[model samples]
Target chain A: MTVPGTLYGVGLGPGDPDLITRRAARLIEGARVVAYPALAGGDSFARAIAANMIPATAREIVMEVPMTPARAPAQAAYDAGAARIAEALDAGDDVVVLCEGDPFFYGSFMYLHARLAPLFAVEVVPGVTSVTACAARAGLPLAARNETLTVLPGPLPDAELRARIREADTLVLMKVGRHLSRLRALLDAEGLLDRAVYVERATLPVERRLPLAEAPDPAPYFSMILVTKGADPWL
Target chain B: MTVPGTLYGVGLGPGDPDLITRRAARLIEGARVVAYPALAGGDSFARAIAANMIPATAREIVMEVPMTPARAPAQAAYDAGAARIAEALDAGDDVVVLCEGDPFFYGSFMYLHARLAPLFAVEVVPGVTSVTACAARAGLPLAARNETLTVLPGPLPDAELRARIREADTLVLMKVGRHLSRLRALLDAEGLLDRAVYVERATLPVERRLPLAEAPDPAPYFSMILVTKGADPWL
Candidate 1:
């Protein structure tokens, strides 16, 4: 009887190889089957971050997760990926799934975890999120004492976004690609434009930190904007 | 004349030693002087996490940062600590300030960074925060697909807490020590009691995860509460 192997969902942190945790590093190096999500044609960012650590003899599984607004297609992709991961687990091969950020924080790994937890022994390893990485790179204190910090997705309606900006003590906007213009206007209306800093590819070689007003017209998908309402003495 | 050495503010992640990033490991191990915040009586949690990696011959500076509601004493402590650190840097000793979680995210390193940035070179290395670590430990997804996640300090007025709880799709309440009862009542008032999960000392050996209702009467200062207002199909 072959014993079922455990499935590990490991976070690789935000783009930098050195940011990978020691626990994640050990698991990635020892795993017999390594899996990561990729676009239809592009390489996996999570896998690329730990490329140096993964053993050459390990079997790789590159699951293609589409980058689309529709949730149905994405759900389908995860379902298929989970099945592939399950096959390896059933075959007594411990599988390591690479995730970009903390697996449970607005991550794609949740889709697989949802399907696989009931059937397999799964463990999650958290990592340095872009939220913290961006704040560090921008040299901005995210919150202090009793200040409230709000994290909003960019696709939210302008009215809700404006309301959140107005009420939040510190603001973080994620997924700021196409919604860059709309977010800029909302921050402007709330008089938070100057307080806002946009970060793209934080902690990476090509990282960019700029005032929200000076950022390019089209922001990258991985970009985020951080706004500290109070005066920044460090800046 | 000795060259002024750069100061490195390194985040040590939540609690797990293996969770430390490679960048942080290198800096901590190679630093000439390592400084970290310590309570008057208790050992520094940041130093304990990296105790294995720090070089035995390195000079250690334990800065006593008071745990008081008043900010004046805290500021004074940091000011004095910064002066002490400056002496090391001025003598061409690169000092590494060890911080738990991301340095800029409500961390003590911010106080030191504000004082030292103008006079000396400082670099911040981000790490995994308790927010993400607790979410992963509790087996809950924080936010996804345009959902707004609000991080509130537990000291807020009940009315304000209730209002933010109503408006937020996902919420994380930090510094949840004595205010656990108040926070529970507010969640109940918002009909979110069942959705709340409390985590203490995440990633540490003494980690605890429970439904908010099941958590101890007096929550530890190191605890946090995560509430997902919407239906979490992944969970």
Candidate 2:
């Protein structure tokens, strides 16, 4: 009887090859099969980050998740991806699924984890998240002492975003691609424009960091705005 | 004229040596001078995380930061440490200050960065945080889509903590040291005890994960409670 193999969801930290953990690097190099998600027709950022470390002889599984607001298409893609990974596991081949940032923090790997965890042995290797990456690049300390840090998506409604931003001691607004203009206006209204720092492609060669006031009109999907309210708590 | 050496704030990730990034490992291995904070009379968590990677030839700087509610003692310790590091930098030897988690996210390195950044070249290498580590160990997806994630310090006043917990879509209560019983009671009051997962010393050999209701009282300072309201968002 062949023992089923374990599925490892490996996090390749925010687009930096050097940021990959030693554990994740070793896993990628030793895996018999590797899996990652790609945009419907675009390249895989996760795979690209770990490209140098992945063994050339290992088989690759690419799940083409559609870039759409509707959840069904992406869910279907993950469903398909999970099935393929299960097949590999059943065949006693350990599969390493690459995830951008930490696997359980807003990562697509969670979708597959939901489906496959019940039947297979799954482990999550956490990675450096974009929140910390942006903070490091922007030279900002997120929260200190008893301060509260709030993370919100830019696509959220204005009222909710405003209330949360006002309540938060430090804020990280993520998925700021199409919503950059509106998010800027909202922050400006809350008197937080000067406090906000916009960062995109953190830890990468082409990374950009500027005050939110000077950010590009249409920021990239990977962009984020970090705002630390009031005085510097650490000081 | 000798060029003053750059100060690198390297994040070692949560406790596991393997979780350290390749960049951080490389920095530690090649470093000539290393600095880290230690409890006034105790061992340094940051140093222990990267002890294996640190070169035998490296000179160590231990800053004995007194663990007190008053900030004056710790600040003075950092001031003294920064002076020593500055002297080394003036001598043209790069200093690597080891940080246990992402340096910019509630890390002690931020204090040093604030003190030395004005006079020296300082760069922060981001690493996996305990928040993500706890999430991964507990198999909990932090936040997805438009959900708001609020991170609160468990030491906050009861009223403030209760209000924030109620308002948050997903909550991560950090610094769950002496407040474990109180936090558990608060969560129970909000009907969130079942939804909360307690994780302590994540990724280390001594890591513990359990439901909040079953967690031990007097949890360590490294402990955290992750609570996700409502049904599984991914499912």
Candidate 3:
């Protein structure tokens, strides 16, 4: 029996190729096989982020994770991908699974890691999360001193979103794509619209940063909204 | 008048030298003058994280930032540090201010950026936050799907902390040193203590991960407590 090779969940950081960590770069570049999730038949943003570092001779496993409201298909895709990765590991071949942002922070890589860790040697390399990237790009301090920062998804019930926003000194709202209008309404009702900054594809070449009030009606899935309540002189 | 050199706030990532971003590595390696915050008469963790990348011949400016409860002295130290950095920028020598974790996420770099942005060109390079690094090291997914994650300072009033914790599906308690007992009490009251995990010096050589119940009464200042509620199968 061959010694099971290690499976690496490598975070490429937020879109910019330069933002890739040295450890992740080394893993991705040296791996003989690299896997990444893509929108069925679409290009992989995770792959794009680390394109500069991935060796040209490396084999790629493009897992087509459907972008839909249903969760079943995504789960199935991860299971299949995990099985495939496990096969390579069983064959004594290390596999690098590229992930956007930090692998374990609300990332798809977690699903694969959950499925594979018990069977094989798995390692996780962290990266710059979108929250930090957006905050840096927006020229705002996320939180300081003892201030609390809350992160909420846009799809949450309006009341819950509003309550969470009100409970914290700083807020970062993710998954603000189709729920942008509803999110905007909630923020407006709470008079937080003026203080919110919207960021899209942060750290990428096509990054966009704007006030929440001026943001597009239906924001892209990759967008984020940050709202600050009090005066933060650093911002 | 000389062309003022840019002031770079470089995030060294969560205690691991290999976690440093390529951009931050370049800035640190090329910088003739570098600055890092250190406790009075103590070593600088930020500098230590990026020690491998910083040029040996670099002029170091170790700003003694007091860790006392008093905030006034800390602010005064930042002001002085910013002034010193500004001097180098004015002299056409780029200065790299080393920061641990993302520079804009609850970091002192923001204070320096706030003071120097108007007078000098400043660039912020985001890094893997301790939150992400801790989550990865702990082998747990922070948030997924529509789950809300709230970050609270350990020093918050117990009532406030409980309220915020209740609002979010996931909680990350930062600055959990002296406040561990109070925080543990709040979590216990909410019946969430069993789900909590404690991480200290994440990604570093001296990293520690354990159940919050088993953690030391007084965790280190660099420690974090993560509490997850409900079933997140990905975790």
Candidate 4:
């Protein structure tokens, strides 16, 4: 009987290759079979981050997940990907699944984990998240002392977004793609536009940081808006 | 006159050395002067994480920050440390300020960054935070989709904590020291004891993860409580 091999969910960290953790780098370099999700007909950002580390001789599994509002297509992609990954594991070949940013933090790896964890030994290597990356690039200190930090996705309803933004001490609004204009207006109404800093593709060569008022409309999906209210407590 | 040196605030990730980013590792290895803060009478956790990579010829500045509720003493400590760092920068020697976790995320390095950023070139390297590390260790995915994630300090007032806990979709309560019993009671009262997971000194040799009900009272300062209120959306 062949013993099943372990499945490793490795986070590649934001977009910068230099930000990849040593442990994640080592895993990528040593893996014989690697798997990663990519946008259908688009490049794999996760693989691109760790491209140099992945051995040329290794086999690659590309799960083409469609960018859609519906969940069915993405679920099907993961189901197919999991079946293929299971075959590798059943054959006693460990598979390293690449994830951009932290795996468990709104990462697609969670779907794979939910499916495979009960059947095989799975290990998750944490990576630096985009929240901290945006914070670093903006030179903005997030929450300090007892201040509460709230992370909200920009797709939430306007009423909910307004309430959350109003109550939040320090806010990080992610997935600011087509919702940029609405978010800007909300912050502006709250008199928080001056304090809000917009960051796009943080740590990458094409990264940009500026005040929310100056940010482009329909910002990239990777963009984020960080707002720290109140005086600088550290000072 | 030689140009003033740049000051790098490098995040060392969680306790595990392997978790440090390649950029942070390179900076530490090539640094001529390194600075980190320690508890007045205790060892420096930041320096200990990067001890192996720090070159033997590098000058080390250990700022002993007294752990007191009073802010005056800690401010004085940072003020004193920044003066010494400024001197090193004036002599054209780059100083890498070692920080555990992301430098701008509730990090003491922010104090120094605030003090010296006006005069010196400062760069912040993001790192894997304890939140993600704890999530990885606990095998608990934080927030996903449009779900909101709230991070609160355990030191918040009881009423505020209760209100926040009720409103939060996903909660990460940090600085769970000396407040475990109270937090546990609060979670229990809110019928969330079963959902709350306790993590202490994540990614370290003595790392521990268990249900919050089983957690020790007076938990370590590095401890955290992660609670996911909703059913697994990915599943």
Worst ten in a row by lDDT for model 2 chain B: B226-235
**Model 1, which residues run further than 4 Å from truth?**
A231-235, B231-235
Question: Model 2, which residues run further than 4 Å from truth?
Answer: A231-235, B230-235
Task: Grade the docking of candidate 4.
Answer: high
Q: State the lDDT of candidate 4 residue by residue for B121-223, as single tens digits.
A: 9999999999999998888888888888999999999999999899899999999999999999998999999999999999999999999989999999999
Query: Which residue pairs does candidate 3 place in steric collision?
Result: none
For residues A1-235, what per-residue lDDT tens digits would candidate 1 score against the true structure?
A: 8899998889899888989988999999998899988997867888888899889999998888788767777778888888989999999999999999888767778888889988998889998999988998888888877888899889888888878888899889999998899899989988889889999999899999999999876899999999988634432
Interface RMSD, Å, model 3: 1.9
- Candidate 3: regions farther than 4 A off: A231-235
Alpha-carbon local distance difference test for all models: 0.88, 0.91, 0.87, 0.93
Tell me the TM-score of each prediction against the true structure. 0.97, 0.98, 0.97, 0.99
DockQ per candidate: 0.69, 0.77, 0.71, 0.81
Leading candidate by DockQ: 4
RMSD of each: 1.7, 1.1, 1.6, 1.0
Query: What share of the reference contacts is kept in model 4?
Result: 0.83
- Residue lDDT tens for model 2, A96-212: 999999888778888888899889998999999999989888888888888899999999999999988888898999999989999999999988898889999998899999999
Q: Between candidates 1 and 4, which one is better according to lDDT?
A: 4
Q: Model 2's lDDT to the true fold?
A: 0.91
Model 2 in CAPRI terms: which quality? medium
Q: Write the per-residue lDDT of candidate 1 for residues B1-235, one digit (tens) a residue.
A: 8999999999998899988998999999887799999997858999999999889999998889788877778778888899999999999999999999889887889889999988999899999998988988887777766678899999999989989999988899999999999999999888889889999999999999999999886899899999987635542
